[model samples]
Target: GSFWINAHIEAGKFLWQRSNKTLDSNTRLRTTGQPGDLDSPGDCLSLLVSEDDLEYYPGLPYNPHDCSDNQHYPLCERILQDTQQLLKDPLLVLEETISINIAKMENNVHLILDTIDKSISAH
Candidate 1:
């Protein structure tokens, strides 16, 4: 979710820079922009870690029934354990994805800068 959101944000920033002819060496790696800047928007992290959303998907130990039925309890418990384990570090995957996306964006920025350098040299 955060990965997609960040990707969209980065893509938007790249496009904005390209359209406005602002993709220069001075452009910094910024997730958020200063007030009045072209990319200045609201917080992205708040969208990632929403308290209200977390309340609906609370995992583990809170299961009220616990699948009391004997036949299904084993399977149910296993599922619960798996979910608990996942919940323990839910953000790990998101963090990794975000890291990868940022790396990709950095690479893209480098490529764009190199192209600009080459074009200016040719002129």
Candidate 2:
């Protein structure tokens, strides 16, 4: 389950009245999942996202997928207490993740240039 997720209905309920928690029962709303039965393999929460979803529902965060599935990568939000203790630098995380893809793109560009150079040299 996610940070605010729970098995009970009360846990899913959002407190509209910020001041009072239990007393303000009238001002409350349940943040339930999409209209469906609990038929998934596990109850863990995940965002159901796909490439096609970009055109229709861009930046919409309502979809939930299997939490345990390795195919889906989770986006983490955390306040850093100590930057030195961090295993990976938060600033370079995006760059590191796409480094391999960037290298492949560079290699492809080099190969294309080499092919063009060979064609000119042969001529």
Candidate 3:
């Protein structure tokens, strides 16, 4: 059994998987072939190509393989020297900022709605 977590975590979320694959340089993974395979195993990730796929564009695509299986671990490059440094965690900081901004925006929207309701009652 082999498992490795790359330096792509944003908070608790995996930053590599996005709704829009173009946003990241990582290879987009192929969906599994089974029907309603939600409960199936193999949630852990891997980046390996089948021997037949060696001639393809980037060669390997990310996939969720059975965690108990052993595969060659991919060498991932770390962008920051010290991930423990708060200032160095760009993804975490950005995610936190976005969350704070969204909360403020929601509060503003609620205030605006209340003001509108009061104006209508006065009218």
Which one is best on lDDT? 3
Off by over 4 Å in 2: 1-93
Q: Model 3, range 75-101, lDDT digits (tens) per residue?
A: 453233243465657878899999999
Candidate 3 residues lying further than 4 Å off, grouped into runs, are 1-88
Clashing pairs in 2: 46-65, 48-63
Off by over 4 Å in 1: 1-81
How far off is residue 47 in model 3, in Å? 22
Better model by TM-score, 1 or 2?
A: 1
- Candidate 1, poorest ten consecutive residues by summed lDDT: 1-10
Q: List CA RMSD, all candidates.
A: 23.6, 17.7, 14.0
TM-score per prediction, in order, is 0.33, 0.26, 0.33
lDDT of 1 by residue, 1-123 (tens): 111111111322322211333222123323223322433222121122235434543331111111222322221112233566687676888898999999999999999999999999999
Whole-model Cα lDDT per candidate? 0.36, 0.41, 0.46
Model 3, residue 4: what's the lDDT?
33
Candidate 2, lDDT over the whole model: 0.41
Clashing residue pairs, backbone N/CA/C < 3 A, model 1: none
